[model samples]
Target: MKQGLIILGVLILGLSSCRKDPEDPLHKTPSSYKPTLVDPATIFPVGKFGMPQLPSDNPFTEEGIYLGRMLFYDPILSFDSSISCGSCHKQEYAFAEPKKFSTGIFGLQTGRNSSSLYNLAYSRKFFWDARQSTLREQVFEPIQAHNEMAMTLPFLAKRLARTDRYIEYFDKAFGSNPNVFDMSKALEQFLMTLVSKDSRFNGFFPGKFSLLSDTEKRGALLFNGLVDFDMVTGLATGTDCFHCHGGALAQQNNPDMGGIANNGLDGNFTDKGYGAITGNPADRGLFKTPSLLNIAVTGPYMHDGRFATLDEVIDHYSDNVNYLSPTISPMMAAHGNKQLKLTPQQKADLKAFLLTMTDSAFLTNPAYSNPFKK
Candidate 1:
C-alpha cells in the first residue's frame, strides 16, 4: 500500500511537469490573443464632400493604431534614440515644428519646413515637393533620411524584436513577427485616425453660420471668391482664393484643379521645388498648395517657411506676387500681375477668418497626444 501511494505521488509530479502553465508567458498561444478590431468608417466618417479612401491591403484596427501610436512617440525607433517622428511633427503646432526647418537627430537641419500633418488622410500627395504619393511611402523617407530619424529597417526591426512588449504588440497588430512593412502600416493607420474636421468653419455648413463674427464672415466670402468685383468698373469684391485653397478641407479637392503650383515665392527658383523630381522646367518653383486648415497655428508659412506671419502671407498675394515667373500657376496668371490689393481692415478680417480654421479639439485631443507620458 505504501509503494502504490509513492507511485501515485510520482505520477502526479510527472503530470505537473508535463502540463502547460497558464501563467507562463512562453506557453501563451497566438490563438489565445484576440486583436482589437476597428471600423475605419466609424473612426473616420464621410464628410459632406467625401472622405479619403483607406488602403484595402492595410485595414485599420484598434490594436494597430495603438501600436503605431507607441512607435510614433517612441525614440527607440531612432538610431541613437535621440528623436522620434513626433520630434519634428508636434501635436501642439498642428503637428508642425515651430522652427522653420526641422533639426534632425544629429543636429542637421532639413532643407524644407516641416509641413502640418492634420488631414493627411485626404492628401493624395505628400511633402512640400509632393514627391511621395502615399503615406506609407512618405513615412519611410524621414526614418531613413540622413537629416531625420536616420534608422534603417533592419536595425529598427532588430531593436523592436528585442523588446518583449514590442514583440507582443507586433504579433497582435500583424498576427506575426515585427517587420518594417507592418511598422509603416501601423503608422499609416494612426495617421489616418487624425481627422480634424471639428473647427468653427465646419459649423458654417450646419446652418451655424453665425459662428463667424461679422469681420470673419466678410473674410470667408473673400476667401471663397463669392464676392466678385467688376474690374473695369472699379467695383471691388472677391479675393479669388478658392481656386487653390477651396473645399471644406481648404485645399484643392479635384485633380483638375492642379496639385502643385509656383505660388511666386521667388522669381529665380532657388530650390527648384517639384522641378527636380520630374525633371521638367515647367515644374520648377512649383510646390504643393498646402491646406489652409489651421493656417493660424502653422506659420512661418510657405514651403521654405519664409513668411513668419499670416499678414506677410496676405501681403505676398495682396501686393508682392511675381506674376512673370515662367512656371507661374494658371490660377496666379488669372490675376495678370495685379495684386489682391486688400485693405488693412480686409487683411485683418482675412486673418480672422483663417483663425476660425483652427481645430482646438484636434490639438488637445488625448487620443493623439504622447502616449508615453504617464
Candidate 2:
C-alpha cells in the first residue's frame, strides 16, 4: 500500500513539472518591450516616443497597478464616496468626460475638461491647464480639490489604513509596514500601465499593419503630404494639418521648437493655458496639443472643451482664424486669408481618416480595466 501511494505521488509531481507557469510570461521587470518592425496588416507596433520620467522610489509593479486600479474606481477616495476617477473618465468615451467639464462629487463643475488617460505614459504634463508635471502629482489634484473628490489625503490614508482589505493590498504591493498606505506611489504604478499604442494610426507607426483602405490610404497621403498640394487642400493657398500636429505621436513638443501653439483663440476667451503655470506672456493661451489617437471618442475638443464635435473643430479652422489672442500661434496666422478648404467629399474622407485613429484593443484591454469588480 505504501509503495502504491509513493508511485502515485511521483506521477503527480512529474505531471506538474510539464505544465507551463503563468507568471513566467509576465514577470516584474524594469525593461520595456523592444521596438519591432512589423507588417501593418498583422500587428500594430508600439509608437516611438520619449520615455516619461518615472520616480525612482515608486517602481512599476503588478501589485501596485492592481491596487491603484481599485482605488481609481473606488468612491472611497471621495468624502461622500459617491465619485471616482472613473466617474468622469468613462471607458466607453475613451476614458474622457462626456460633458464639457466633469461635475465633481460635490456637484460643482471643474474648470477644464478631463483629458483622456490613453497613452498617458508618454505625457509630461497632466491637466489641460498644465498644473501637474508628473502623473503621480496629477493623481492628487482631484482628491483634495473641493470641486472633485474633496477628500483630504492624510484623512483618506487613515481611512484606508483601518481597512483590512486595503491593509492586505498595500502590504502585498509595497512591503508590509505602517507607512505602506502611501496613495501617491500606488496610483502612479497603475497610471503607468495605461498605455495606448494599438491604434490604426499606429499602423504607420514603425511600419506596422501595412494594409489600409483606399480612402484611408488617400487620407494618409493628405495627412502626411504624399499627395499634391491642390489635391490635398481642394485649391486652398496655405496650411497643412500635419505641420503642427507632427511626428508618430501626432503632437509635437520638441526642445528647440516645442509645438504648444495658442491656435488663434479669440481674446474674448479667458483660459490662458501654459501661461497660468509659467506666468510667461509667450506661453499665454498655449495648451499641450494631444495625440490624435482615439480622437473620435475623446471629444468636446480644445483646452476648455469648447467644440463638441470634430466637425466643429475643423470648421473653426476653415477660414475662420480668430487671431484675437496676443499669443496666437504663428502657424494659425500663417494660414492666411484662405483655409484648407476641403470639398464635401474630401471632408467626409478626412473624418473617415480620423476614425481610423481609434484603437479598440487599447480601449477594451482588460489590463487597464478596473480590477476590483463585483
Candidate 3:
C-alpha cells in the first residue's frame, strides 16, 4: 500500500512538471522591435488612415525603407540638386508647404498648394486632381514637371550613378540592379513608411485627455452623424458634418468608397474633377475627398487652397454657392439650397474637434528625418 501511494504521488509530480508556464518566456531577452511597430487592434482610429495595401512589386522592407528615406530628403533627385521631395513637403507643417503655394525649380510656384503627406497609406489615387494612379507613378510627376524638378529619368540616373555614396546605397537597397538608380521607387518606399498614427485620437481617447472637455465630445458627436445630414440644405442638423467627411479617416470615400465631390464649385460651368481623367462629364468637379486626419495642419483648405482659415471655410460651406454655375454636388442641396449657418460657438467647437486628430509622434519621428544628417 505504501509503495502504491508513493507511485501515485510521483505520477502527480510528473504531471505538474510537464505543464507549461505562461510567463516562462518573459525571462528571455528580446532582440529588437520594428520601427513600424503597431498594435493591430488600434490600427485605424477615428480620422486615422488604415494600413495600406502595398503592391506586390514594391514590397516593403526595412533595408528598402532605409534606402528610400535617404532618397526622400536628398535634393539630388532634382535638376539642380537644390530641391527635394522634402523641400515643399516640410515635416513641421505635417509635410505641407508653409507658403500658400510651393516653389519648384528656378523659384517658380506651382499652380496648386503642396498637399500634406499623412494618411497616404490609405490613398488609392494621389494629387489634387487625382491624376496619378499609384504613388510610384506620382513620384516622377514633380521631377519631370516643367515648373517643378524638370529632371528626366535618364539624367537623374546618370546623376545618381556619378556619386560613390549613391552607388553604394543603390547596391545595398536593390540587389545588383540598375533599377535602383530610379529615385522614384526609392522615394515611394520611403514615403509609404511616412505613417502618423500616434495622435490624441489615435492613442487614449476620452480617458487620456481630461481637457478634451464635454463641449469637444459633443462637437465630435455632432461632426459625426449623431445629427442627420440634411440632403436638401447640405447643412447637417444635429451636426451631421460626417456625411461629407466621414470614415475611420474622416474621408468621404475610403478603401471601400470614394468621396469625390462636385460641391457647387460651379453649377453648369465646371472644373470637371474626376471627369477630366476619365473624359466623363459626370465626373465634373468630382475631386478626391481629402482625409481630415490633419485638416488643421494642412490649410488654406480645399483643392485650390482658397480659404486661409477654418472660419472662412466653414462660411463657404454654411452659405451655399448658389451663385456658382450648375455643376455643384448634390450635397450642396441640403441646407435649403444654401450653406450652413453655424453659430460662433459651434464653429469653435468644430475646430477644437479637428485639432484632436493631429499626431505629434509622426510630425517629429527621427526615422523620417533627413538621413544626410548624422
Best by lDDT: 1
Tens digit of lDDT per residue, candidate 1, span 225-314? 744466786533777777888878888845437568888767798899889999989899888988887888888889899999889999
Ranking by TM-score: 1, 2, 3
TM-score (C-alpha, index-matched) for candidate 1: 0.88
Q: After superposition, how far is residue 282 of candidate 2 from its true place, in Å?
A: 2.3
lDDT of 3 by residue, 218-264 (tens): 56766764445558964455555676677555666542244676666
What would you estimate as the lDDT of candidate 3?
0.67
User: Candidate 2, overall lDDT?
Assistant: 0.69
**Error of model 1, residue 347, in angstroms:** 0.4
Clashes of each: 0, 6, 23
Compared with the true structure, all predictions reach lDDT values of 0.82, 0.69, 0.67
* TM, every model: 0.88, 0.80, 0.78
| lDDT of each residue in 1-374, candidate 2, tens digit only | 99999999999999999976633312223133321222222222243554665566666666676777888888888989899888988776778976898899869999888888865656666777666777778888888899999998767866776777776666667644212235677777777666666677766654443566777665565665522346563554223567666666676644124456677656744877788788987787777777787889999998778889988876776545676667777666555434566665566556777778888988898866776664
Which structure is stronger by TM-score: 2 or 3? 2
Please report the candidate that would top TM-score against the real structure.
1
Alpha-carbon RMSD of each model: 9.0, 13.6, 16.5
Q: Which regions of candidate 1 fall more than 4 Å away from where they truly are? A: 1-31, 206-208, 226-236, 253-256
**What is the Cα-based lDDT of residue 190 in candidate 1?**
89
After best superposition, candidate 2 residue 330: deviation in angstroms?
2.2
